[model samples]
Target chain A: MATTLHVTLAGNPNVGKSTLFNSMVSGKSRISNHPGITAESVDGFRDRDKDRLLVTDLPGTYSLHLDLPEAKLCRQHLDQDVEFAMLIIVIDAMGLRRNFQLFSELTQLEIPMAAVVTKSHEAQLRGYQIDLELLEEQLGIPVIGAAERSDVRSLEIDDLIDGARIPAQIPAQGQSIEQWGTDLLAKVSKPVHPEQARRRRLRDDRLDRLLIHPILGLTLFLVAMTLLFGSVFWIAQYPMEWIDALFGKLGVWISSRMDEGALRGLLVDGVIGGVSGTLVFLPQIVTLFFLVSLLEETGYMARAAFVADRWLRPFGLPGQAFVPLLSSHACAIPGILCSRLIPDRRDRLATILVAPFLSCSARLPVYILLVGILFPDRPIAAGAAFIGCYLLGAVAAVGTAGLVRRTLLPGRSLPMVLELPPYRIPSVKEALRIAFDRGMSFLTNAGTVILLICIALWWLSNYPSTPAGAEVTALRESAAMQSDPIEANSLLERARSLELRESAQASYAGRLGRWVEPVLAPVGADWQLSVAVLASFAAREVFVSSLNVMVGVGQDLEDPTSMARIRGSKRDDGSALLPPASAAGLLVFYVLAMQCLPTLAVTRKETGGLRWALLQLTWMTAVAWILGTATRSVMMAMGFSG
Target chain B: MSDFPIEDPQFWIVTLLSISAVILLLWSRNSSKKRDQGGSCGGCKPK
Candidate 1:
């Protein structure tokens, strides 16, 4: 029979506990639940000599007192009274004091255990002194230092497996161990019980002057945020452009080889043009997520949350909402997933409801397209406008969260009892893996949703034919533009005119747009714009194709000149709607809109009712309509007609 | 009555000055608070 040692891996959040699990068992288990639960129990098998050990990776938690879901799970798992050879408590060496709190409580469980101090390399560099034997004496457990570059601890763990047991009483010579353990607990005494461990580590009064000094700290935070946003946009732009060019060239090359047909059109426009156009933004997404992962891993993000907590409090949200909201910038899927950490149901719900407003990777394409259309000549200006839109999304999210909490789902702010894990230099490998996982998740999970929306939009704008004369004229112009290099303008114009003449009277999408046109007409949206808005309801990115279809651009897999036609298209009376300010408004609208059907579905699934999702849809749509109307009205008043 | 351009140099100078000032003030406040707490609790029994 195999030795079933029920070992639990417990540590503070982001203390390289997951990485250690990966290294130990060579497994990549997501180990999550749908409606969100504490760390779902994960089991891994490891064989040393003849004994096979079963290791369970418990969720990283601050303490074992049954506070959070994961902590409760950990406590419940231990209560089963299954005999464990040893409970291997892993602690970051630099964070020994904080790590010891949990360790001390675990010892109180009176389980046979051994301590493995991690990140010895960092401890050595930081000039932090820790005596392993002394700690062992203090905790009445065998203690060993572990480093990624070393395997001695693995050997120690294996050796201890057979012999490790909770001794009821030790020889009198081990009396010093009890004293040291008592002394360690005495070190953290403070007048106020809660937030003591955190405040002491931060040296609260000093940090508050710089971090929450009302005026100074707030100003610093704002400055830091502006720079963070500006840098993400400016620095990532070069790589983003290279990716765009690469995709564009590949698209052009692929289109050149195929004969005009539906298959060719689907291959070129639907899959490559639609999917890759969105996918080319992966590098930017990866970079942003990578930076976020690093910030989170390093513990500065906790400080940021602490700083923002006061501001966040007004929205009936805890400071813990900040990191999850910030994480949404990469994508809301993970952000919604991370909201599980917020223990309080109401806070988590509010956080999830508002999270999609933090412009995700899905909205990036819509923003880029609008920027390209509106400010073709000013790339830098367009980038700034894009950043501004992100800010708008964040502001809208926070503001709306406040309104919703007050009016609809009134709730109290959750208790803020987060543990601030000591700052450690983020492992590049760990950060990269996290970034890759997130980026790939977008392609796999969210990408499927996007593709379905695209195909549906393609069908919407394609069917219902024009009259024969108009169709012939459209085909001739498309072919002329494709064959001739310079007549692209005429071809594009012909396509646009054809769309204007026939779309509303013909295609299902066009008909739908015209039907809804009256509703949005007061908002200055034409039928074509109305069509785009309707498509955007499927997803924000669908707005581009909806527009492409409205222009009668060869959205058909057979139509090779579709893109060129789209570029040169104009509205009635030869006015371009793709100018900068208009694009900015569109970008703002997409950023603020609850436009993705899949996100709505997921929100409904997460909140367990249509009530929250319905509220989300109504609020986001109302806000988008108001903001878009105001933007267009103001621009028109400034004599800039769309 | 507004700085129209908000020159980059001026922005950086203001940012650095504000940040350093905040840090210094925070350090001082933290030191004082720590002292106050330490003094008050010095003679008290351990929990």
Candidate 2:
């Protein structure tokens, strides 16, 4: 029989539980849903001195009295019928009393657990004295102090593999019994969980002032947000450039080596170019995640949430909704997942309903393209416009949610009572580890999706035959005749004109675009632009690539001239079509549309019905159409011409 | 086929390498603060 020792790494959020888990189990991380919950569970393994130990990294929770899915799962996993040889409770050494609360609960759990005191090096620097033995005796569990350099983890697991049991649970502290259970039980249960006792003594008076004292808390909130922005902007440039260079070099190298053909185009222009364009942003994503993980790990996130509660209440959201909303800024998947924190079904629904408005990173490409084309010299204006769009989306989302609540579904706000976990210095190792993993996932997984889409778009745009092919070939040869002649270049460009060359009549995307043109005509859309908009319904970033392909131009998103050409093109009669008002209208249309397929997939799964997801699509699309038409009319009235 | 944006790819590569070093440095400083403050309560929750 294979003897496997089960060791659980537990701690409050931001206490470096995941880091220690990673240290124990290198390269075996798996994100799995818990046995019966929608929340994600991370599990892994490690080998110590020829013995195998299975490690489970439970979500961060303040106590066993869990209301949130993350906390509930943590508590549920602990009570599981499966036998565990030993439980290793990871405590942020800097947060002794607060960590002790959870430690006390674990003791009451009657599971064999030992305190693995983390951030030991910090204790030395801060001149904090720890009576290790006293802490061990007080909790009736073995206490081990370890920091980044400490490597006794393998040995500790070896001991567990050798059937080591956490010294028996120290009975609960007596002082806290009356508050939780009964005074009668308090007499017999001398020390109710020390955590309860600590919680009683923990002064919310000081924290409450800084956390909820509307004025100061809001200021601190602004400062934190500023720092986050600083990190995202200031720190990410080098890595972004590096990624760009890497992909550009790879594209150039591949294109050079391969014959000039469809395969080469697919590899260089489509795959490398598109994927690298997106993946370059991964460093920024990781940096954002790192800051958030650090804040969350060190316990400031809860306080931030707590502080923002009163302000968020009137908006039909609680303070906790802020984190998920903030997360939505990076991507909607995690934001949607984080909504599980909102216990009230109505609030969660509202959050889900409005979440798409948070301006996801996918929109970044489109935003960048538009900003570059229209506002190239004014980066600040571009950024301000970007922020304005986010604000607009948020405002719209809130208004729509309020409307939905009153008419479609109505419910009262869930009372806000959140645990304020004590602050601890976040483990840097843990932050980096999370940042690395999440960053890698974005690069490898999401990058692949974007890459495949780009390649498909490239293929569609460059495939099959047009009867004008002979004329185009002759033009190409004639252009080559005088390689350096400017007039020859213009003539070759004429060969690529949008003349009623008839070939586009058979191409798949063109046919589909035309088929949908009738439905879009009222909304001021031509078949080519309509196809781009429809493709964008799959993903906002796909808009540029799809449009680029539809126009038979390469995917050079930064090229203003290419966009101008597409914008300047006309119908067979040579009538002007992509007018200023209509172009701005289409831009506004995409701006308001909830057109991401992944978001829809996630919404369906999260809401547990296709009904809500379809409703989301219908409502958002309707909103987009109405708003787009109104905007176009307004712009036209303002003397904008097509 | 377009001319590379930077005058020297290697130079930019080295610059990125150095920037990564700087990031690691900053990350270490932050980690050290957490390490040094380890063990025993200072009466404040880990924020």
TM-score of chain A of each: 0.75, 0.73
Error of 1 at A492 (Å): 12
Show where candidate 1 strays beyond 4 Å: A1-7, A21-57, A80-88, A104-116, A119-127, A132-180, A183-212, A290-299, A333-349, A372-383, A408-456, A464-505, A515-574, A598-608, B1-47
| TM-scores for the candidates | 0.70, 0.70
- How does model 2 fare in lDDT? 0.59
State the lDDT of candidate 1 residue by residue for A1-642, as single tens digits.
766666666666545554445455644433211112213455677876676677776766767785776678678877777765467777776566667556656766677877667766545544444666666665666766765422332545665555555633322354553464457535422223335444455654465457656667767766665555445566666776676566567667877898754444444555455555456556656776676666665555666666667778887876667756765665564566567678888888999899888887667657766665665546566656766787788789889889878976697886455444445567677568766765775565235544544444444544444543556466665767586655766666566555535533455666787799777754556567777787666556556555654554332222223333345555544566454345545566677888766567657867899998898888888888788767866776787754
RMSD after Cα superposition, model 2: 11.3
Second chain alone, TM-score for each candidate: 0.49, 0.57
Every model's DockQ: 0.01, 0.02
Residue A226 alpha-carbon offset, candidate 2, angstroms: 7.7
Candidate 2: tens digits of C-alpha lDDT, residues A2-91:
567778777776566654666677643322111111234566766655556787877677777867777787877887766645688777
Can you tell me the CAPRI class of model 2?
Answer: incorrect
Prediction RMSDs, each to the true structure? 15.8, 11.3
Cα-based lDDT for every prediction: 0.60, 0.59
